[model samples]
Target: MTTLIVLPLLWRTRAPFTSLLCITVAGFVYLATDGPGQPLPYSPLVAIFTVAAQGGLRQRRFAIGLGLPLIAVSVAIRTNTAREYLFAFFLFTMVYVLGVLARTRQAYTEAVELRAAELEKARQAEAERAVERERARIAREMHDILSHAVSLMIVQAEAGPLVVRSDPERAEAAFDAIAGAGRDAMVQLRRMLGVLKDEPSAAGEPSTSRSPQPTLAGLEDLVGEVRRTGLPVTLAVEGRPRPLAPDVQVTVYRVVQEALTNVLRHAGATTVSVRLTWTPDDRLTVSVENDAADVPGPRVRPGPDTGGGRGLVGIRERAAAHGGTAAAGPGPGGRGYRVAVDLPVVVSSPTEVRR
Candidate 1:
């Protein structure tokens, strides 16, 4: 229990290389000069443990080589018979392997921590990409809402001035149409913002600010709006209509909105038809076609901002995201333009009551 025996174990962690050299030299000197009754100490293994924990493969091997010679010297000086040498050799080997195991355990812990850090970094990168994509989707939605609302309001304003002096009744009706379209736009925009704020609920559904999402059920009101703008739009529904998932309904609504907006801007057609068909095989079909108007075939192309060429691309992307299909082009005989979208529906069990 002298200071030399206990003090080396304390320095093993703080200064391992120096501690190893000191313990080896002191143990050798003690065995060379001390009396036979005094025992060789177990303190040298403490230094070996520290070196193996801190050093790499080559350093641990070198520490082991440095340690074995001290063990041999102690055995040669202390042992008097062959049996004593064998017992000393076996004991030294067992202690050496214990230090190597300590080093292996340290290396394993570090490897695990490095892998965990890499996984966290990859997860953060994926989250960033998802946010960018969501921002782009919201931008597209705002563009569609504002462009459609503004066009209807502009048409009403242009007509109100022309009829205000001659017919007070018609003037009032035109102003009313503009006011209605503006109100609807405000409500829809607020509803979209609610979706951005409201997180998913416990039921695993997106709990938005509004209760019901726009669906084919609202097609009549949309047709009415276009008719007010002087375009006679007819609506027809086919097959047994069924309720769809909220997100799918939004996509369907936007597709029809964009298609009709294109009809007002590009096709100079006075008459248009909106059709919806539901199939037993879990698909909903939407078709919009316009009759050739005073303006001949498809008009001279305008930029993407007004003509809605990019909007049709967006429609296709929405449908494809849900494993659906969309087509757009002139109708048979090249008369009017037609846009058709087919979307897959998640069919619920018949036992569930219809909302």
Candidate 2:
């Protein structure tokens, strides 16, 4: 009877329910036959523990139904004193509770591991999205810089030869404009590349020495550069001037830059107007409008080579990045084209406000 009860325990892990049933039946038979006494039923206790820890819900419930009666009978046959019976009962109950705790801990561990894996996956996805957004931003910046520069250069190059023989000074100025635009494009490209470089440059200086992003202060320089292309442009400001965050300034500058570039490439307008309005409601509105051309001159749509149709899209993206909105359509009275953006501004506290 002892051999039969003990031997079935080997199968506890692989077949916990069957092992428990065999051990329990042998224990009952051992008790009935008045088998040799033991301080405690070791095999039956181990089998019950294994079943509780490893068996499914229904299997564990069956073990519970069998365990109480087996413990009752074994204690009844082994001891008459209430103290001995209570002690035996306590041992069985403690072992069963320990098995239940082991099962709960294992389940909790698995659940925690699963949650950790899910969080890691979400983190990786967010990182990939951030990389994609950065790539798009860089592409937009490159397009704006090259498109504006190349457009100005093209206009100057086309007109330079026309006056080269008749007017030496005017032809020289146009050539100079072409050279200036090329040089400016190179400088801006270098600055952008510097930001991306991880190592020191050829001169041994770290590439972190890049220029700051363009802001409202550079608006005059930008307007003058385009004016050199023989296109008349004016700038106006309304309301109080105040400080703006660096990103907001960049958005404002890029919006105007793209708007002017589009005008030069496609509008054929004789004059352009750029206006900035700082409203009382803590908003900044940027407007770039070009008058209708008196006579249709050279005009080009953004073709495949010219990054066609992306200029307006880039403007809107820049505005949206700053929680702003962009609109482009015909100017007032449907005479010309206008690009406008509305941007929210951070209000300055009294202490931070300029006198």
Candidate 3:
């Protein structure tokens, strides 16, 4: 009989209502058989606490209603004086308080656990986003390095013969520039591979670098090499130039590199102009223009917004990443193709402007 009242409590978590009902029925049976004159068993106390702790207010009330009546009957039949009834009522009240407190504590603990789980999920998502951004940056670096190197190399390779026949001295310089471009491209590729090697994968595997990233300072070497291809690419500067963040300068460098690569690969222009201007408001503006490619249609095409394209879309993404903007298309009067970019520079080095 005692087991019948308490055994149903095992279902309290999964089937709380059914467990409460079973406990109530067993309690009534115990009272009927034992008679109200007898002391109430400990089973009723356990059932009352379990129901109150496991259920909502409605369930707690139902269990309390059933138990209270039985408690009153037992006190009425067994007690000869008021003192016993008072003691029993005091004991029942304490147990009821204990159950309510336990329920509240349980709900609070569950709520905390739910919030913690949500925070962990959000943290993982943010980590994934950072990794994606880093990967995109690295991809742009490699594209600019390889595309510019290969395009210059191809042009010099083709022009090497003509220059050799007409002017031996210039021909040697062109060949040397081609070799330099090849070596530079190889060094950059190796550095990229090293970065990949250093980046530990999720599985804890290491990928396996030297050479600093390219910057605007390195453009002189680049322009000299491009000029070796028998093209007139002039550079101009306006406004005072300030030191920029390494990453910001890299973006500017790549925008120029990618744009020039487009000219070398697709544009049939002999004369191109590169311009750099610094605004009074902590910004750098870069533009490259060349006589239109002989081929019909635009030399550069639009790519997706996510970047990684060698076309105008990639330029837009790179600019937008740094809170900047870019535009590329046929120049005015249909005389040439032009690419222009505006990049923000939050950090500045010492004041210096190179002409």
Candidate 4:
């Protein structure tokens, strides 16, 4: 009797069928040994079988198949008098109904648990994606701010000597610009490091210094810095350059900066063109092209420490984070490299912007 009661609780396991069979056999044996003079005690073996069959079998069929035999056996042997037979029938019906209800309840509970687990997994995946996006944004910002500053310093450093011979006063101004550019670079680097600190720590202390923000206004200074490199870079705007969100402006500036840097490092081109176009539809597009060098020289291999090979990779990541695309390779003329990026002018809602 105890075994029959306990079997239903274990019906979720692999041996449910075995448990059902054992409980049924035990009930029949007890019936055979105990005479009818005593009460024909009922066993919940049929309920256990009904519940086990709920694992796969149809409830109506299982109840009829199992119930009829026990009923017929009790009637034939007189182990249960007619009055007791009706009472046992009522009792077993209630037991089977309760068993089915328990099975349904258990199934519902398991389904809820599984759904909760799936939702949790999806939330975690979304969080990881957001973190990756923020890292890319910070990287693009760092490249734009630092590259602009560095380009200016390089141009000023080169001009210092030329101006020194002609006008000492102008040479001193160039040196002052170099110092200012260095300070700006350090400030930008600090801001980037601060953003990166949000990442989970694996070891020591995190840096806390913040950097100044860069916007489209900074492009003028960037252009001036590049011209200092002795490469003639022209900046043209097709549509009115309107103020943009910090991130979008930063992305535009970085795309142009990286393209120009690649021109200086690889193409050895003397003349370069940069065009920024803004439309009423809130779209921003940037194009950078440089004339092929006079004599095609050997390509300069990027060194490990310089992170030189990752420029295109970095640019692509930046464009994608802003819901835009970047294309780079050979230009239509098949002589010079052309890097272009198209970014939507509209800012996504706060909800759309991943934390």
The prediction achieving the highest lDDT against the true structure is 2
Positional deviation of 105 in candidate 2, in angstroms? 1.2
| Order of quality (lDDT) | 2, 3, 1, 4
Please list the residue runs of candidate 4 whose C-alpha ends up more than 4 Å from where it truly belongs after superposition.
1-37, 40-42, 45-63, 72-86, 116-137, 162-166, 198-212, 227-233, 240-246, 263-271, 279-283, 291-307, 329-337, 347-355
lDDT of 2 by residue, 115-151 (tens): 9999999999999999999999999999889988988
TM-score of each: 0.75, 0.90, 0.80, 0.68
For model 4, what is the error of residue 212's alpha carbon versus the real structure, in angstroms, after optimal superposition? Answer: 6.5
Output the worst ten-in-a-row residue range by lDDT, candidate 2.
346-355
Residue pairs with backbone overlap in model 4? 191-211
| Pairs with backbone N, CA or C atoms under 3 Å apart (clashes), candidate 1 | none
Tens digit of per-residue lDDT, candidate 1, span 1-355: 2355456777777777678777777666666677345644567666766776765567677777866675666677767567877776676677667777877887798999999999999999999988987876887788778867877787778778878999888889989999999999998787787777776767988874465666656667777887887777888778777767767777877888888888766647868888878898878898899875666432223455674367887888888878999999997689888999999886543321111
Q: Which digits, one per residue and each the tens of the lDDT, describe model 4 over residues 1-355?
A: 4454344445534555455555666566656776334432333445354554464576446545876687668666764577767876777666667767877888999999999999999999999999987776666666656655665666567668876988898789878877987986786676566675554445655544344455566667777666755568888888755556677776776777787767655535767888887778877788898776765422232345444557778788878878888888776679777888888875533311100
RMSD of 1: 5.7
Q: For each candidate in the order shown, give its overall lDDT on alpha carbons.
A: 0.75, 0.83, 0.76, 0.66
Better of 1 and 3 by lDDT: 3
Alpha-carbon runs more than 4 Å astray in model 1: 1-26, 33-43, 58-73, 80-98, 165-168, 194-211, 239-242, 295-310, 348-355
What TM-score quantifies how close candidate 4 is to the native fold?
Answer: 0.68
Cα lDDT for residue 174, candidate 3: 70
Residues 1-355 of candidate 3 have per-residue lDDT tens digits of 7677878877777766677678767767776788344434565566566767887778778767866776677677665468877877777888778888899999999999999999999999999999998887777777788888877777776667766889898778778878999998998887888777686656877642246777778777667777767777888878878888777777777888888888877646768888998899988899999986564322223234313445576688889988999998888787789999998875856533346
Candidate 1 whole-model C-alpha lDDT, 0 to 1: 0.75
